[model samples]
Target chain A: MALSVQRCWNVGELSSDALRVAVAVSIEMNRDATPVADSIRLVRHSGESELLARQAFDTARRAIIRCGVNGFDLPAEKYGQWREIEMTFDPSNMRIK
Target chain B: MVRFLTLLAALWLMALPVQAQNGPLRITIDEGVIEPLPFAVPDFVAESAAAQQMAQQIARVVAADLTGTGLFREIPQDAFISQITSFNSPVQFADWRAINAQALIAGAVSMEGDGRVSVKFRLYDVFAGQEMGAGLQFDGTEQGWRRIAHKVADAVYSRITGEAPYFDSRVVFVAESGPKGERQKRLAVMDYDGANVQYLTDSRSIVLAPRFSPSGDRILYTSYETGFPRIHVLDVASVGRRVLENQPGTMSFSPRFSPDGQTVIYSLTQGGNTDIYRMPIAGGAPQRLTSAPSIETAPSFSPDGSQIVFESDRSGNQQLYIMPASGGEPRRISFGPGRYGTPVWSPRGDLIAFTKQSKGRFHIGVMRTDGSEERLLTASFLDEGPTWAPNGRVIMFTRETQGAGGQSSLYSVDITGRNLKRVRTETGASDPSWSPLQN
Candidate 1:
């Protein structure tokens, strides 16, 4: 799982490995199906204090791990060329980014 | 070539952020659209024939409590992609996700052996495809099903928001009726959502500003029972009450409890002059907190009890002032173009919510303790008496429409200045004081 996730960050690759990884996660969790972010972009809370910034980062990570429960539905045919998913997780507020 | 350069750019990005010094891609979200979290609450399953009617009603009440906040949107039953037939069945996360529901709720009702109603529920995070919290149950008299539902909603709200729940709390307020010139007021207490309203005092005499104690077991209000203004303390659970002190020469009004609930501060009027006075709740000699010729009333204590913020006319116009909990010199905090009154400190202790009147408009607003970052959440013909939810995320206040038919009602607004909603009350309610979370 670590190797697959790590390879997703390799540049210029178009393999749909990201989708396979997400689907594997979904079946492992006993989910019939789910919508996970195609990409997860970890971001920070700008102009906030250090404590607030740290909280923002933690909140973003929580959202990533939480919402990825069922997994993203990327195309299987494109699995071989897929790369890492980047999502915008803005943790300053309650709503999804 | 350009194509090769484009591929190189993509490769550059992929190779980047491997514990890079710059960190993740930087994005500034100063203000983002706040859409309510979508949730689905299927009607509670009836475990027995006696629980059939209550099963659906209880679920409706729970859904209403959450949707009323404008923080959770309920996907109507008609739009359901799948049904929850069995309460104990594992949830189909796919079905809920198809409907774009972030949260799903399932409950069941049964008749308990003790002749009471039993209600239990489980909350699931659909996208997460897992039960977010432990399932819990409540046993209560059948007639009190609404309270039980509120308890369930309170648990769900707390788990999702990571904040204290106000759904199970109560509100003490003044129920007003009749024409503006000949209005009748009564002291009343109701569930926070304005259900099961019980009147404690009739309209025989004018009553105003019913405030709940820290424990929510007692209420302090002013009444003209003896043809003069006097503060009365009432036991909430029982209908019994008594005058705080029968000061023959002075009138007392605008009472508030200290953080400890051991003392109260109110305004005392005598010889056409009004001043703020503090006294022990268990009965004691009154202590004077302010000595001035101007009228000083609506005194509220900071959450920490270290400071008192109240409205005063000492500056020639109505404005807010903060002073030490112990009697001392006062400092003015409001400088905006308006007359401010009824400054209530937030439970979070970070902001002070107040009622402001400016240019023929009244507004509910919040500002930092030191009088900074003032933001008005609502404005109307006559809005006043702002009260904070237990979590300090929302403020409920009185908004009275203009004209001869003007009637006062309760309304709430999130601190974000969005999701302004009118609270349901059986009668015209005013001066609402939200109680602390019940034990």
Candidate 2:
């Protein structure tokens, strides 16, 4: 059976602004990342303008990258299974998928 | 993936400054590790009452420009062991060396009876115990005192760095403000440091990516005044502008001038396909240079106008390509993992600065003309549009924050990718095009 997994982590010591920057860098460093709005729409169900959604998603994504910058924890035994991952983070649910 | 080295690695914060020159008075900067030469800028000797304030201010600006480069550190006046009361005074190298000042700049400011300001400065190699060159003087209107200071600083920077002076150059960029949903952008011009900013157009229309001509007196920009992007050229001195002629139903943007300032190359969009074209600066029929099914834009000419480097998606993914100036078969230059855009050829003709998107990150990077030795200088959320410094040692680009509160600002990073700093501006700024050194 095919398995899919999602994980979430706290923003850590970096302020959301810094993480947003990190996320933006991550978005920029990776060319294939969707237009910021498309990614934001996946998680933003609230009546938020594209601007607010972009900000909220950027903050959450930045948090993820900031924590991952120095290396993050993973099940070493299943490294091959989880070698690559992509997910949309929902701040409302504090969930990552 | 190539990684950028953190700036100044292995250097302790409280390390003592070294003043004694072991051999030649030079600091050859490596990839990221650099020892900023300690320098001193004493208050310029004031020759008249009107010149006193200007003298003090000039020295401060000169010091700020040098220290901001990350290649030089200015010792505070409190650490100064001796004062420069006269421009012609003999240097007391020991005193400067005591404060770990490897270089010294001494200047004199005077006011002519005709209300003009005269500024003169000399740079010294404190350890070498000699002035680097003969003292130079700049004369300008009293109201333009800052320009005079900049000229003096430019001379000092050039003498020390062995690069053409960018301190005396101006930047043309889009001044931005307001909410992300309804942003306002206007074309503006200012000194490289973002002072003396003057708006060239009103906020009623959107402006993007203003580029300076090689002569520094004319500017080309993309404007939406007619409700679609079109190229416009303006005379800097007069602030008068005229949009380049457009073929019906076509949109033109991303315009740049040739080295000779007689021709312009830009991108034109029609039938949902974009291609590069060239036209005379005085307005004439544009000669199509590229015919492709994919998008081809952001064409920049080499220093000699022999070739054009531009972005295209002729491949399944966006990549950079080089073609002859007259347009013919093209050569693919980028084979990296991600897409590249805004390939600006360096004025020195040795490298191309570009924006790279890879691994879910955006970067401002540079590479050789042949596409080897790729170095990512800065990685951020939205860094794009790299323009070369007059000397080609530095690049200035636009970096916008992510999210609603996000706004665009101008940032500069050296070609070595060692120093990254935000350029100070009164308002948010982007799409900076650095001009050639002023005549």
Candidate 3:
């Protein structure tokens, strides 16, 4: 069965390809979401399903890599079957310049 | 023949029930001071065996809450002179007035098989020799019998004093019990006189400044559970809650709802600077209201929602200021020597209650909206966070000690600096916000 996830995101621009890439990277890297700014903490509420979580991990992992975000680490794909998801992203140490 | 007629008239007069001859309606206030009516609350007469014990306990609690308000004095049963056998029994007005008790209370209690108890009470003006108001009855569970009694007392108080009664309300506060450094603070609420206490938040994280909604149904408070200061709204009935606007780097604290609960006004600290912000309860963009170099905390809305009074150090020292709810320039209202902060507008909209620090002593005081007639009500080692009673006649505040083993407790006083008393709590309590009377 597919997982259901509710996401809280920042005020950042995201194209469809970038969104796809982000989802893939998240699935591959096993991460939930990325921080867009110091003002926003994006949260994700997703259901259990190893395959779906893996897919989400892959998508988010790819997007962060393409965005050239340094120190962007994702969780493992095997731990994706969470009934509720909560994530906080910090931009204090990010090198955006 | 004459002797026989006199005997017949005496026998006819004996058939009528005896009542104190009614006197003229005399309601007068001499210099706005009426002697506290002396009232007696003997153990309530329980109609059933199930309520016999509970009825007496509830009656005592209700009596204490009323007596502590300073508007009434309990006539000790020892001096009651007359033992009331039934509610319908005649009251000897002369006997009550002889003891300087102008008012009397008599009640009956009954418990049903369904675990519900009913209380019926009446208030009589002894001097006027008549019932002053209508009789009242309340239904609740055995555990809530005390609250039912309080409601009856509050009704009598309002009818006699022409002011709303605060006895039936609840207070939300931080319940602390332990050493100073390792003290555990949990969000707890109890009846106004400190009974039926129930803890709402665990001691998992630091919680401060729990405020009741205008409707008295929800609580808005700040918690450091997520390793940062964030605001949370908890439903008092269901104990359900949701984090309010979880923005990173945004330290949200000091939340007070508007006169209407549509918007929550709180302080958000970002980049080491704190200012006031308003956010919808449903979670949306927080609109910044104040931009000042100094800290602007403790935002309280006026009764009409047109303005807000907050504490700010923009004048190089903390002082009270008033500003429009929409963005505008703030006008400083306090010019005292030491420092004034934590300005809470009264529900009556005539004055703002605040905490004033002067000469190493803190005091709870009040001033007119324009900062006139500043009256210091209580002086202590450390006093802060003045919350007003619904009627604006009394204020409840936190009193803290300043030492290695200092503790905090709640105390209340009248606006006129009369009737200062320590409010009882299950544990050391502080930051008491009196809730509005329940619907």
Candidate 4:
């Protein structure tokens, strides 16, 4: 339905040789659409690190969207749904150079 | 009749063998009139007799370099009361001071058996009656004498002015040729004095405003490589590059790195409107920082990263504004009568330099962080993109000449609006950014 993204600055000052990045994407899917694939990637300087931050993010996003669809008895689709997407920092994906 | 014959014979005799004295070389010394520091560079005398021509050539090159800056005037060789006959003897400073010279450049040239030329030059502050600095010697091929002279001049200029010498640095700019409608441009870099040029990119598409990163290892420029104006960062060391990511339905250009080299702040265009955006250097989605309806671009970060100075049209005309790094409402900082753009924060974080367009003319100007003390430094048909010197005392920018036959080149002006001089390039060049001294 709608997506929102936020950024963090001054992360370098916190650590000289390391950087921390987090992204939270909130999306609403159409009623007729089926959840097929989802991914969160943190990239910089031609390198990327991808992973799930917390298990609760996935559960809450799916739960809220499922609850918004078909009035709590939704199959895969019946009405549009709202989902919360979040990712966490992985040091391997971030480098000073 | 006998006395007249005797006088005529005496005159004829006086003119005959006296001609061997190399003709008194009558020379008029120009009077001091708030001109450049007057100095004399006598022809270098070689240690051995076989190196006469090379020695003279070296001194001539050094004299030319010093005079070209318009900051020094040279006394012609004919004005010299005595030719330099020995390099080992002490210099007669009083002789130069008698000619009202403020400074003197004296050197000796030598030739090695291997065909290399060695030159030793000394700069004297004639008024102080002291050698300004230690004498320097350079060894190079016969053809490198010109560069050796330039190096000597650079040293003398640095020692006298207390500013870094730019003569040794090279500038990279967009070289243009051909007609106005079908102009051909290529990325070219040349010596600071306009020599040793090498082209990096050819004009297959439009490229606008190429800027060197602080390290001089890369360049960020706006290019139409993908059939749309986009910002591309090129690695000067490797000639490799990559397109910066832009949000969907938006175009991005005007890229500059943060002082730490961790983020890039640039302008993103969407729906016929433009705003500023910052993204991580490693790679990530860009986050929009300004939501102004009018054009908001040329975002330069303060040296400490506490603030960002950018040009916005929110005031109904392009004006400079300062905003927090976290993105919030921007406060108006420029109240002048012109439209300002290309705001570049000074390296010292005390001033913001910009380009102001007014009355159909563009000018290079600077203002304080709070927008007070606005000073316009240069005005011309086209002058924009003020890049600060490493010490923040000078700014270099592009000056576009107009008319049936017009050209663009780089020029630098002191912060006080003095010392305006044309920066040389192989062809017509523009968009010069000075890099930090190499570590």
Candidate 5:
């Protein structure tokens, strides 16, 4: 699941200010591994500025919706185990500059 | 019976831990792809008959500005699954997503009876299925429609990238003509994208290194109008100029305005000794900043007016040094091999951009304020005189080709070493200084 999200995540779309912060998003998925519409939301952020936090959250939300359009590739038998997921997108290690 | 009930409650509490371990899965994603974001911009809807042509042109310019950044790729209209025929119409987010456009821009242009044009635009995040930010509108004259388009692009860029807007700014540069041996250089100002150029001075006398004031109201440049290199300040509005420093047997050039635009810091050469100096912009006795014996020139002030960065050969080779805004001992910030010159501090005050020469190639590079993490953005036969964009994310400089027929042209590169593009000009242009965003 992490690998699938990482593939769709475009960190380059984030601004420099947004890159300095980390955002955690909570998602509620249906039984088929497709994220429920309007269920992706930011749970927490590490920045003081609400603007930067929002920017980071928007990027994360876009990645989730973009990658989950066709549904995540997951085991349907373990649907109960992955119905609710928490994703923390941290860019500390990926800062090129 | 009470003892049995207590024992059963304790046993249930013990099982809670095992069940809690099966809670929702948590994942950390630290790696992500770095690629140009795909976007689509449909022709703006014309709200008036007179604005029909302006609407299409505005949309085209907006697309060009965003894609020119190299951080965005515009999806062709033919590939768009849905058409934006009306500004008030609802966006088909699913259609945009099917076409793989991560962002969408829709706008409208209207012309009032008083010869005023208004442009409004809204940016959308297709994948998120919502507007990225509140829609914005700009009003200007019909002649200034390009500026209006740039204003729209700036707002969209700032909202998406979380960076300040720079597209609404201007650049002052030296326009060149004739042969390399007898190049006629004149001072000219134009939009940041090299549109709507207006000449400030004639090419009869040679001019070099034109710098815009902090407020973009005046300009400082070096000219040989008096058979000697001297600094001059020209009013950007009236095009009237006067010699800044006229002491006999002394030369002054390479001038930059202080952060507050009240003082000018520059290089002055007297008795064959060159050093840095500062004086009032209204003409007064100059205060020498560096009394070093070696040549020192190309002085630029930090955004806060607390420090100044300049190039000097006091260390036996041309290198960058920072000193107090007032006179004081300077500290070297550049240690990499090869010679460095033309150091300009970034507007954000985090980095410094400079022109470096290594081996046989010249390059435009940027480093931290303390001269760390040096990265070259461009390498060519002759590249020099880097000026930062208003936002400091981009640097524009001069790139001269080799040979006798060689000509100088203006080029800008992203500080991240991407989007190196030649700016379009009517003639050979060089020594570009970008202006702050217009009010």
Candidate 6:
């Protein structure tokens, strides 16, 4: 799931400030692993300001929606286990500083 | 009893969600692709017959500006699944997503009876299925339609990337003509993208390295009008100029304004030795900042006006140094395997951009204030004189080809060494100094 969504995440689209922070998005998915529309919300962030937090969350949300358009590749038998997922996007290892 | 009841309620709430049965699946994504975000910009809606042509032209310029950054790829109009027919029409996010447009821009152009034009635009995050920011509108003269288009692009870019807007700014550069050996240079100002150029000085006298003031109202450049190199400050609006430094038997050049716009710092050569100096813009005694016996020039101020970065050859080879804005001992910041010169501090006060010559090749590079994490953005036969965009995300400089027919032109590269492009000009251009964003 992480690799599937990482392919659609473009960190270059984030600002320098946004790049320095980490954001966690909570998403509710249907049984087929497709994210429920409007179910994505920023659950937690390390950003210092509201603007930076919003920017980071938006970029994270885009990655999920863009990759989940065809539904994420996940196990159907464990649908209940992965119905609600928390994805943390951290760019500290990639940021220039 | 109350404590027991509260604990029971909390436990019940925690157990209600299905994820509570087994903690929600947590995943960490630490890596991401570094690719241009795909975007689409349809022709702006024309609100009046007079603005029909301008509506399409404005949209085209906006698209060019965004794509030129190399951070964005514009989907061709033919591939667009939905057409924006009205300014206030509902956007079909599904159509945009079908075309894989991560972002969308919709705009409208209208012309009033009094020769004024208004351009309004909205940016959308297609997959998010909503507008990225509030819609914005800019009003200006009909002749300034390009500026309006740039403004719209700037707004969209800022909202999407969280970077400051720089497209609405202007650049002051030396426009060159004639042969390479006998170049006729004049000072000229134009839009950041090299459009709507207006000459500030004629070609009769040779000019070099024009720098825009903090407010973009005046220009400081070195000229040989008096048979010797001297610094001159010119009013960008009236085209009137006066010598800023005219000490007897001394030469001064490479002038830049302090962030406050009250003082100018440049290099002054006297008695065959050069050093940096600062003086008030309103005519005051010059104060020396460096007493080095080597050539010290290309002084640029930090955004907060606390320090100045300049190039000096005191260590046997040209290198960048930083010193207190007030005269003080300087500290070397460049220790690379090459000669560095023409150091300009970034407006954001994070990095210093310079021209480096190594192994017979010239390059434009940027480094942190401490001379660490040095990255070269361009390499060519001769690339020099880097000036930062208002947002400090881009650097524009001169790149001249080799040989007798070699001519100088302006080129910009992203600080990350991407989107290297030649700026279009009527003739040869060089020594570009970008101005601050316009009011």
Better candidate by TM-score, 2 or 3? 2
Better of 2 and 6 by DockQ: 6
> Model 6, range A1-63, lDDT digits (tens) per residue?
676678888888777788988999889999887897599999989998878888888888899
lDDT tens digits, residues B238-303, model 2? 999998956779899999999999999999999999999999999888999999989999999989
- Candidate 6: CAPRI quality band: acceptable
Please provide TM-scores, in order, for all candidate models, with all chains considered together: 0.82, 0.76, 0.75, 0.66, 0.95, 0.95
RMSD values, in order shown: 8.0, 19.4, 30.9, 32.3, 7.4, 7.1
Candidate 5 TM-score versus the reference: 0.95
lDDT of 1 by residue, A1-97 (tens): 1212221221111011111111111111112222233333333234224333332332233344444444433334433323333333322232221
Candidate 4 segments exceeding 4 Å error: A1-97, B1-35, B43-70, B83-88, B108-120, B137-150, B246-248, B304-306, B324-329, B348-350, B403-405, B424-426, B437-439
Kindly provide the TM-score of model 3 when superposed on the true structure, using C-alpha atoms: 0.75
Q: lDDT (0-100) at residue B407 of candidate 6?
A: 94
Please provide, for model 3 over B1-439, each residue's C-alpha lDDT reduced to its tens digit, 9 standing for 90 to 100: 5764465345324422231234211111111112344567767777888878876887787678768877677888778777666777887866775665555777888988898888888877654456756888888887777678788878766655555667888999999988999888899999877888999989988889999999999999998888998999999999888899688877889999999988999999999999999988777888999998899999999999999999999889999999999859999999978899999999989889999999999999999999998989999999999999888888999998889889999999977677888888878888899999865
Per-residue error at B87 for model 5, in Å? 1.5
The digit string of per-residue lDDT tens for model 5 on B1-439 reads 6765465446434433433366656777798888888899999999999999999999999999999888788999999888998999899899999999998999999999688999999999998788988898899999999999999998888888877889999999999999989999999999999999999999889999999999999999999999999999999999999999999999999999999999999999999999999999998899999998899999999999999999999889999999999979899999999999999999999999999999999999999999999999999999999999898888999999999999999999988898899999999999999999888
- Could you tell which candidate, 3 or 5, scores higher by TM-score? 5
Docking class of 5: acceptable
Docking class of 1: incorrect
Task: Let me know the DockQ for model 5.
Answer: 0.48
Relative to the true structure, candidate 1 reaches a TM of 0.82
Q: What DockQ does each prediction reach against the true complex?
A: 0.08, 0.01, 0.00, 0.00, 0.48, 0.44
- Model 3: which docking level applies? incorrect
